[model samples]
Each structure stands twice: as C-alpha cells, then as structure tokens.
Target: MTLASTLLWGVAHLAAERRRTGLALMVAHVLMLAGVLTVFTAFSVDLLSLAVQPRWLIVLTVALVVIALAWTGVIVWSFLLVRPPRSDTVGRLLTTTLTIALCALVLAPTAYGARLAYVSRDVVNSLFSTTSSTPVVAEDPWSGAERVNFLLVGADAAPGRPGVRTDSMTVASVDTETGATTLFGLPRNLEQVRFPAGPARDRFPGGFTGSVPDTPGLLNEVFQYAEDHPDMVPGVQKGKRGPALLKQTIGDILGLPVNYYAMVDMKGFAELVDAMGGVKVTIEDPIVYGRSREGLLPPGTRKLTGEQALWYGRSRTDSDDYVRMGRQKCLLNAVAKQADPMTVLNSFERLAAATKRAISTDLPQELLPAAVDLAQRVKDTRIRSLSFVPPLINTAYPDWSQIRRKVSEALSHRPSTRSATAGRPRSPERTPEAPVSLDATCR
Candidate 1:
C-alpha cells in the first residue's frame, strides 16, 4: 500500500482507512499537477524565460525541498498505519529497510534540483547584480528599441603585462523583434579612434594619441589608457572606467549607441571553453603561435582543447589579424551552436565558475530574462559579419564617414545567402563589400 501511494500519492492513506487524510492528499496532488500544467502551457514556447528569473529559481528550490520532506513523511506515516500487525520480526525489519531506501530514492533527484537552482542563483548574483549603473525598463526592456547594440571584447592581461589590452573588439547590433544580429569586427591596430561627448573627448580632441611614440595610440590600448588616467572619466566608476571609455569611443566610431559591454579575460577564456567540453572548430590552414613559433594546429574538422582553441583563434604568426578575425568568428559560432542545454546543464557548475571568473559586464540582473529569451531567438536565426580589415579600410588613416556608411548599409539590408566561398579563405581579387551570413561562412 505504501509503494502504491508513492505512485498515486494517496492510495495508502485510503487503504489504511484514513478517509479525511486520503482525500486531502489526493486534492493537494491534483492542485499541484494543475499548477504545473498551467505554467508549462504558458511558457512552453520560451522555457528559458523561467530559468532566467532569479526569484522563480529561488522559489522552486525551496518548494522542491518542502515537497521532498512532506512526501517522505507521508510515506513513513502511511507505512506505519498500513503495515501488517501480526508480521514476524524479520518481515518487519525488511519492510522498514525498504521504506528507508524508497525515501532516499525520492529525495535524491529533488535535492539535486535544489542544488542546481541555488548554484544558478549564486552565479547570477555574482555576475549581474543590481549594482549596475544602467537603467532597466521594468515591464518591457526592449520597448521602442529598434536595435540593441552590445560591445563584446576580449582583453588579454597576461602574467607580466602591466595592464589589460582589449585585443579583440566586436560590436553586435541585434534587431529587437527579429533577432537578426550584425557583428562588426574592428582590428586592434586601428588608429586615430575618436571618443564621444565626455571628458575623454575633452582630453583627445584630435582622436586618441598615445602618450609615447613607441606605444602608438591604437584601438586596443583604449582600455588601459582610461585606467591609467581616471581623472579624464571622473563620472565613471573606478574599476569599470576603462570599459566605459572603450564603449563610448567604439559607439562614436560606429555612430551607434553601445548600450552594454561584456568583456572576457583571455586567460580565463580557456577555462570557459574547457567547461563546455571544448569547442569543435573547422580549421582551414595551419596556425602557429608562441614566442618561438613552436605551437601549430593543422587543418581539419577537430574538437580542440582550451589551449589549442585559444591559439587557433588568437595566433597571428603566418597569418594576420584579419584572418584571425574570421577564425574567431568561426570559433564563436561553433561554441554557440554546439553548447546545447544538456551539455551546459551537465557541466553547469564548472561553466558558471569559469564565466564569473572570466567575464565582466554592465548589464543589470533584471534584464537577464529578456536577454535569455533574445538569445534563444537568436539561436534560431542566422548571424551576419562585417570585418574592417585592410584593402576594405585603411587602419592607419580610416575614413570615419565611410566606416559609418558601411555600418548603416549592413544594418539596413538583409544578410546575404550562402556563398560558394563559405568556409573558404577570401580571395585577394574578390570585391570588398557588404555583410555575409556567419552561418554559411562558418559552415
């Protein structure tokens, strides 16, 4: 009778002649079931919406613990009330042991679910606390917004380096409704970068000029530059002043409002890749790295380790930054597509730890639900890319007018169809124009 109750939730109580208790348990079970069904029906299309809400996560965690305790208590009470009164000593011992085992089996998954929820809340709090300065719209985060622009940067703060340098910079402008994303890649060596209206503009009227001739002013140095001179951006918070400056400068360069910035430390980035079980990438050619050019990853479709994938994306020995940019795009696409829910959930703890260690952003926690929903939508669509490399634009003396025009054109048009040149190296003779589909290019 107790075992049956574990399945039906109230069978044992009725069998034990407890009419009131049996009816109450059955009603509670039915009500819980109905609530679950209603919630699932409402959020079936966007299940990630629930996961992203910290309040719901906490509530669910507590509810699971309560459910486990109540269920186990009922199981014990039911067994005591319904057990055979004239059973032998050995039979009683056997039944008691079996009941204990059954309770453990029921508690196992419930406990695990609670643990995951707690860990998720911890990570969310650590990364996206309400301490952020950016204002969030409570009801609709994306209302009246045609496009939301984010600055995604990869900064390298190596062992011996004095300060961090943002070597990889990409602006992702996403359409609010369609989830159509356009990625604009800027070379690290791009010089004469302008700043928007701020103290930074007051200091650098003629664009960013390096303090020293040997360390020429370039796009990559913007972060450390702001850090070194905090007086220039006094309104910004202390630790994040650098990224704030870079965000404004990049926004000015693109002629778009860079709404948020997410930066990942290059050193910790390897751990993130490993946490996701490493990313599968298609290599088109041999890439070399290291001070002595000792490391080489050959061409093929391969699942790369953290270190290998880092080199594959960052190395510029035989190739230049432009080629490296394309490879980075391909690697990002692979990680985004391949890191499915099962893999992430299985390795969630490690992924969360690595993410918190590596990434820094200004986005508020309240916006995470909307961000998660948008990400799910983005996964279903194609991503487009525009690289500002040599021949297309001169890094030394870039035309700000032409750069903005190209950006406007790319944003205005639909992404191109799959080209025969997808996954192939760009030909020197090929015409330099327009954004190409990232899916086709990475495929």
Candidate 2:
C-alpha cells in the first residue's frame, strides 16, 4: 500500500523469481520506478477522466497508481536481475537505461491496450441492435419510476462459428436513481418472438421445447424461416437471417429499447475464464452427464473447462433449461465477480486477440473507455438478478394453453400464470419470449 511496502514487495518478488540481485538490479529497479511515473502520469490522465473522488483524493489516487506502476515496473526488471550478468557497471547502466526506455516504448502498448478495451466494449454494445443502443430498460409497473433495462445476449454466432445457438440470455434492469441492476434470465424455450426487421413474426423457442432444434440447428431454422416468411422475423437478410431475428426477439422482451449486444464464442468463454485464472463458483447441484455434450462436471467449487463450463451453463436435464439458464446467469455473475481486473489488464493483449477472434459487438467504439470506467465502479450491490423462465415451465404442467397464458401475461407485465399451479422459485418471472422489434432492437 505504501511506497516502501510496494518497493519492498517488488524487490522481494524479483528476488524470488531470480536467485540474485545486485547493484545493476537495484539501478534497474530505480529506473523502473521512474518509468512508471512517466507512463502512468501520461495514461491515467486520459483513461480516468471521470473519477468521482474529491480533488485531493483524486490526486492521491493518481499518486498511488503511479507508485504501483513503478512497483510493477520494478517487478519486470527483476526478471533481468535473475538472469546471468545483465552487464558490467557500464553495461548495467546501459541496460537499466535501455529498460527504462523500453518502458517508455511500452507505453504505446498501454495506450493501445486502452484503445482495444474501449473498442471491445463499443463493438459489443453496438452488436445488440445496430440502429441504436438504449441498453438500460428497467421498470416495475408496480414501482413508481421506470427501471433501466440492458439487453444482455450471448450468441455463439461469432464469425467462423456461424449458426451457433443463443447459449446465454438475460435482461438486465437497473433503477437509474437507485442504481439497482436486476438481471433476469430469458428462458431459451418459451416460444414466439416477433422480429421487427426481417420477419414480423419471428419465433424463438423456449429451451425446454423437447422437439425444437438445438441452438445450432435452430439458428438455421430461424434463417430459413426468415427466408420463407420474412415477415415473421423482420429485418433479416436471407443469407444470414438467423442472427437478425434472434437479435430482434431479444430486443422486444427486455422492454428497454435494445441498444447493446455481446456475443462470445465457445473458445472466448473458456479462454476468458482461464485468463482470469478460472472463476470460483459455488455449484449447488450435481451436473449429470448428457449427450450432445456429455461433459463430466463435478459439483462443488471446481474450475470448469470450455466444454465442461458450457455444459454446466447448458445443463438442465434435472430442472430443464430454465434452471440451466439460471446457472448460466450465475456463471456470468461469477465471471464478473471473480474477474481479475489486473489479469484483464495484464492480459489485455491476449484478451484483445481473443476479442477479435471470438466476440462480435455493435456498440460504438468511442464509448468503450467510459464503459470500462463504469464497470470498474460497479460493485455487487449495484446489481440485482431476475429470471425469464416463467413459473409454468418450472414444472411438468406447462401445457400449451397454460404456457400461452403465461406468455400473454408476461407481455402485459402481469403476474406469472403458473403461480396457482406449479411451485414458484423465488425469481421474478420473465416471459419465455421477449425479442426486440427491429425499430427498437436495431435503429
């Protein structure tokens, strides 16, 4: 925390990494300290312009961050000290100077990293509905003011992995003044979602629909349906129409005009978890093995691989897809909860590479830095949780008539249909199908 403690830790970590530390190392460390000052002073001014701290606190925080950077920089130099002779006195001085200069050079990467992170957020946001992004749509008809709603959807449709399913879906609603961000899971099953763009009557099946196509196949089905019945899922191009319909469907349900969307491919999710040193999740139930992806998932707090994690998110054999949707929502929360900002920072390059390779977003590029800034400040209390899996599907009594009743009630923002029948989980009921209209979803 203090400068001395930071310096000591830096030296100690260096020593631990390398058996030896000499005058050259010491000099390198000092230069590292200076280099940190130079780089951070330059970057923080640009990245953190919207700090809420009082003037004094802001100044103090900046000072501390610079010190931390210096400490971190010293850690980098420590690696060199462990190596064989970095150089003679003159050589060491030259090497130290060179390393310092390298830090200056590395600043480019930091700025570049900032830019990449910014772009990533923007792209994801923009991807939701290209026309505009009004992500915060939250309103409890029972409550006074309208709530903020954010359309959160994860499509496996990233390039190269086209026709992938909607692996994750949730509507995030926040009370603007109160800053209560409630996340609700949208059951992949449910049924009809009229799209605004291509098909005016596009339909997204509920996850539990036993005969409905898998996500991958469903993607094609939607596209084909769009091709044949474009009015059903409006705003869809026949060639790659599924994504368009799906996006529209998601937009309609959230109530908040659809603004931003983020799609993470299978590889991206796994790598992101691993990149964050794996998320620590408290698994409450035992995940049984299943086909299509018979992943061996052990219950408890264990690190999940790509497939294992996917299956974990997708597993609903016991409770069906509704519960699975809840689990996926938890995984997202866990990912954000356990997310290592530093790891994300340090691995910005890696994350960026993965971002381009495995994610697609439509958010404007410039809004990125602000998003990261907002994200950094958002503590757990600011977030709330909800589920789109209506109470009807929670049990076996979800007959078509009952299910349709639930869907209608949901659209009208009324109480769930199954409250009188099936047991209710302590979750806000989200209609099975609430896709966005093309006008509201995109532009």
lDDT of each: 0.81, 0.49
Counting clashing residue pairs in each candidate, in order, gives 0, 58
Top candidate when judged by TM-score against the true structure: 1
> How close to the true structure is residue 109 of candidate 2, measured as C-alpha lDDT?
51
**Every candidate's CA RMSD:** 6.2, 12.8
Instruction: Give the least accurate 10-residue stretch of model 1, judged by summed lDDT.
Output: 421-430
Model 1 lDDT tens row, 1-443: 88877766788889878889898998887787788788779867555666667888988888889889988987898889877665577777887888898899889999888988988888887887675465667566765576799999988866676788898999999876668888988999999888888788888888888677657899999899898898778977777889888888888888889988899887688898999999888888888856578877888888988888888878888888888888887887788888898999889899989998999988888788788877866776777778777787899999999888778877766443334533334334334454443323784
- Cα deviation in Å at residue 325, candidate 1? 0.9
Q: lDDT score, residue 150, model 2?
A: 49
Error of 1 at 201 (Å): 3.0
For residues 230-300, write the lDDT of model 2, one tens digit per residue: 55544645633544555555555443454445556666777766655666676777886555445556667
Candidate 2 Cα deviation (angstroms), residue 23: 27
